[model samples]
Target chain A: MKFIVSIKMVPDVYAPFQIKDGELLMDGDRTVLNAYDASAVEEALVLTEKHGGDVEVVCIGSAKASETIRKALAMGAAKGYHIQTNGDETYDSSSYAQILASFLSDKEYDILSFGKQSQDTDSGLTGGMVAQLLNLPYATNAVGLEIEDNKLVVKRQGDSGQEMIELPTPCLVTCSNDMNEPRIPNLKGIMASKRKPVESLSVSDLGVDATALEAVSKVTSYEPVPARAAGKKFEGEPEEIAREVAQLLDTEANVL
Target chain B: MSTLLTYVAISDGKIKRSSLEVLSHCKSIADAGGMACEAVIIDENATSYTDDVQKYGASKIYTVEGDAFKQHQNGSLLKALTKVNEVAQPSLIAFASTEGTKDVLGALAAQLKAGVVADVSSFNFDGTKVTAQRPMMAAKIMGNVNVTGNPVLVSVRSGSYDLKENPATAEVVSVDVTVESGDLRATLREIISATGDTIDLNEAEAIVAAGRGVKDEEAKALISELASVLNAGIGASRALTESGVYDPSLQIGQTGKVVSPQLYIAVGISGAIQHTAGMANSKVIVAINKDADAPIFEIADYGIVGDLYKILPTFIEEIKKIKN
Candidate 1:
């Protein structure tokens, strides 16, 4: 069995985001592997380790994405693949799905995995779109996964509870963060990652017409949410503070 | 053929409030465009929610009833939606942003060859194209997006729009959309419920959340007591949830659940940017921490500079006295 996992590097959720000249300033912002995508990579690596196969990490981004792919490689992925994008162009979920489906068509894989969502946009669309594009059996928000008798069994989080699902080998799953605790890349793993090969491909190389990859939606503006002003503060004894806080919430905040 | 359609999701045999909100929004968009507002419901008893959706201004309800929809499989759902599309030919489709419908909307977008504007917080119509404002970069930067083509699909974030009462008569029409046996590529095995019968974090009106400052294991019970007293959901920051101090389902942060509760009480949380991003949208925020300079105070409407352990007990006592 061979596994292919789609990963993304997003702005660190803990860092402050800034807008410059009416655009999201990504160049200077700190980047980290999407937390959910890291869980996806962990799930894929676990499955591959159990089933005697190799896991390959893929992403669609600028040159900086190589670091993200390398992070996955350090976490035990066999290799990494980067689909270089033309800078300054934002692609929607549909275009990204189309490109990934086209790329996977020529390759053979038993399973495809993706993060449940990206923290940046939180669209949670790519994996399902790709599954639809490929017409494959798919599941999302999987908290549990197992491979048995050439079938993929998964437990996914739903509205009310977790639903267990069983699909065929050639299936796709979007892993929720709870699927597993992502392993940190150790010093030896980082050293080994330096020796591992990372392959790169442009849209043209993947046979996708660069001009045809137009975004379905265009961001007309980017701005920060207005900051809330600091209000009254209560100090001193716990009793005094608690009473003041409660009174303020009930009278002024109107939320009690 | 130009229609504004909203997909009404059924949970536990009822139309969710978030779905009704989406329907209300869709109706407004339809009114603006001079189009009809319709709703598509897929359930064993699809017509059951006709009155509910109609109350939210849906002029017509499309029903697709079958055991295939009893357990929501994306393949079966797409087929039913495709059938509805063939009949209605909606120019625009909308869905409520939820864990239950996100993947379905994604698959539907690919099947219909339509572009999707997902998790939109607000919408603006300039008599032609609908521009949606959505949060990007973890609610730090807002992205104003324009959905250009026909049959554009969007998922409105929960609580983004109010559910308006438009009181109208909606015709219930059943569509003959059956799932072929061969199309069943996935099979439901079982369902596992999460622990604790507390209110869901996303659905809670008020939340009592704990952060890393609650050092001891016994503090969880203290927070739980406070939550019960306030009739609020119990939530925790990633530091607590990831460290096995609390259930992961109750984690509220950037990588966790994003909530817009009417009231939020943070105990012992030195608000990281990630945690703040999730709860900043709450109507009123109160932070109780030992550190006077905890970042949570930046957005908190009320701040208590003291140990949460001592403060929380007194706070609960005060609230109980007021209630009594």
Candidate 2:
């Protein structure tokens, strides 16, 4: 079995961000691999460990994305594929899906995995759209998985409850944090990653269709979210605080 | 501009509130363009919901009734929706940001060769363009998106749009479709129930959340008691969920579920940015923490500087007394 995990580099959510000239200025912010993508990489490594195969990590970003891929390599990926793009290109889910689908169409891989949602965009659409483009069965928000014969059994999060389902091989799975704990890279693994193989490709190299590359949605402007106003504060005995809160809920919130 | 179509999600023989909210949102977009707005419902009891959806301002309702919808067969549902789209010729299609609708909308967008905006908080339209305000970077930054596709698709975040009762007489249209078993690539095996009520955090009216300050599993009872007194849902910060003190389903953070309840009370929570991102859009927020400078207090509408263990029980008692 062969696995491909797609990862994205995102700014730390806790870091303060600014909007300048109608665009988000990521300047001075540290960028790291998306936290959820770590679970996808870990799930792929575990699958490879059990089934005796190699795991390849793929990412779509600028040249710096190789560093993000290197982190996955240090964790245990055998190779890395970076789809090189400029830093400012705005590709919506459809265009991103088209790029991944076009690249993976000619490649021979058993399973393609992604994080359930990206920390930056939180679109949660790429994996499913890729599956649709490739006309393959896919599962979203997978928390558990097991390979049985030629089928993959998965536990997925649903609206009302958790759903256990089965799909054939060559399927796409978007892994959530509940899947497994991602392992941190040790000194030995970091040293080994320096010698690992990494490849880069462009849209022209893959012969991607021009129509597929057209972005239908673009960010028109960016703004910092308005901070909530500081409201009434109560500091007193527990009973007094409770009474005040109860009164506030009744008068202001109307939830009492 | 052409018509707007909204997918109304139904479960357990009734329409979900999130879907009605989206339908109302779609109606506003349609009215802005001087076009029609319709709703598509795939369920066993689609016709039973015609009057309910009409009350929310759907001018036309397409109900595709079958057993396949009982378990959310996305492939079949997409096929039915496509058939309706071909007839309706909608320029914009909307779905609520629920698990099933998101799944279907993703594939449906690919099949229709349309552009998509997911989990939009708000949207505006001129004569020619639709601009969407999306909470990006874990709700830390807001991005104004301009959609320029021939047909646009969007999934609206729950609680982002207020539900307004704009009554309209709806013309019910029945869509007959056949579901081939062979077309299904996957099947729902079983739905394992999680602890507590089935109300998802995204749809909860009120939420009482706990954090690492609660210390132990036994301390969670205080939070639950407060939630019960307020008739709210129970949630937990990522720290408690990651520590295995609570189920991940109850987790609220950047990596977990984003929620927008009418009233959100954070007990024993330090208000990490990631956790606040999940509930910052809530209507009214209240925080109870021992530390006066906790970040949660910055966004809280009401703040109490006290120990939650001491504050929660008395708060619950006071709320109960007031309610009675």
Candidate 3:
């Protein structure tokens, strides 16, 4: 089964940053492939590797996104499609979903995949939005995926339990990072990625009205999360401190 | 008057308290803004929850009942929500963020052409727009978001607002929905439920989370005993869950469940930012780890430097004594 996975380039959440006067100030330009998308790419690669098929990735980002696409190519994806955008546009989940939907409108694929949510934003709306816009069957927060009887079986983590769902071909799924540990690209794979093909296109080239892609929801500002003040730390004999803290929970904290 | 509709979520034969919390908040907003407060419950036994839902001050209750609504299917849910939105014509639709809501929120928004914000910790609707604050960059920072549309959609994280009871006499309105077989693109095979009577960590008042230090069955038993003593839910760090020591449903971290319980006890957890991102909002945090300098201590209201094997037994015994 051929798979087309939608990937994203996000700011590295691990990078050191500061918020001042409602503005987030990062230390440097540290960007990486979204962790959840990396898992989606990895899962698609694994499935296509087992069954004889090709795994392709489509990404929506600025010029810097080619590095991210190469990272995926280095991990064994057969091809990449970069939907280039000006970095300054304030695009929300809906905008990205519309762009991806327009790009994938006439594309042929058995399964369309995406990360459940971006690591930085965590909005988790784009995948479902794209599925809806494309009128495709979809599932989200998938922890396990398997191909059986020409169908995609998804084990999605729900509120009550893990639900096993089966969808026919031409379906969509948003993968959770719990699915698998993404493999790092080796030296040989990196060398091969340099020779891989990456097709770059503008939003207008996809026949989408760029003016209609206005984001209804936008982040107005950033602020530091109020720090939780640390209380007293007791270090002494295990039994003594344990009993004392338990009493404190009852009398002082009133939680017990 | 414009309506503010709250989607009351049902899980495991019970209405989610978080949904009631959202309703309570919406009711207050409606009252202050001079708008009508309403609610929608889409379930197999939707009408059964009407009385309980009325306690939160929904003047009108919309119920969409059928066997197709028995389980969480995004197709049926999106259709039901769309129908309800058409009937109610709500200016703002609110939801208590759940896995079910997350599965369908974006699709519903896209279908309705409505602006949406998900997993917001706090939000308010002004006359013209809805503004919300949510954790970004893995809870390392907060982002204020503004959403604009005819009917703005917002999902609130559990524990973001306190539950305030304001009873109202609600008029029950049954919504007609038909889910043909063709509409269901995905079929649920089965559910691998967690073992019996495991409290939901999202709604738990207190949580006892095991980390890497909880290695053996003995430590697991101790953690269980402590949780039982305090009537708290049992959770696990990503290390324990990924290592197959605990169920994935019990995993508490950025990639897992983001919880803000009344009390959170971290046993044997050397709190990484990823883990703390989920539980940092707990009202009271207690960290018990042998490593005195564990980052958990930085945010824990009470930090005890000790081993779990020794500390847990004494701690559980003392808590049991205190409860008695």
Per-residue lDDT of candidate 3, residues B1-324 (tens digit): 778999999988999989998999998889898989999999999999999999999999999999999999998999899999999999999999989999999998899999999999999987559999999999989999999987999999999999999999999999999998788889989889974578998889999999999999999999999999989999999999888899988889888898899899999999999999999999999999999889999999999998889898999989999999
Clashes of 2: 0
Chain B TM-score, all predictions listed: 0.91, 0.93, 0.98
Report the interface RMSD that candidate 1 achieves against the true structure, in angstroms. Answer: 1.8
Query: How does chain A of every candidate compare to the true chain A by TM-score?
Result: 0.89, 0.94, 0.98
Error of 3 at B294 (Å): 0.6
Q: Scoring model 2 with DockQ, what do you get?
A: 0.74
Writing each residue's lDDT as its tens digit, candidate 1 over B194-280 gives: 644767776677999999888886788789888888899888998887787876667787666777788999999998877887788
List ranges where model 1 is wrong by over 4 Å: A11-17, A28-31, B126-128, B195-197, B214-218
Q: What lDDT score belongs to each candidate, Candidate 1 first? A: 0.83, 0.83, 0.93
TM-score per candidate? 0.92, 0.96, 0.99
Best by TM-score: 3
The i-RMS of every model, in angstroms, reads 1.8, 1.5, 0.8
Candidate 3, after superposition: displacement of residue B34 in Å?
Answer: 0.7
- Pick the DockQ winner: 3
> Model 2, range B200-307, lDDT digits (tens) per residue?
677789999988788965578887777778788888998887787877778887767778989999988999888988889898999988999999999999999998
State the local distance difference test value for candidate 1. 0.83
Off by over 4 Å in 2: B126-128, B196-198
lDDT digits (tens) for residues A135-167 of candidate 2:
988888887888878677888877666788888
The ten-residue window of minimal lDDT in model 1 chain A covers A20-29
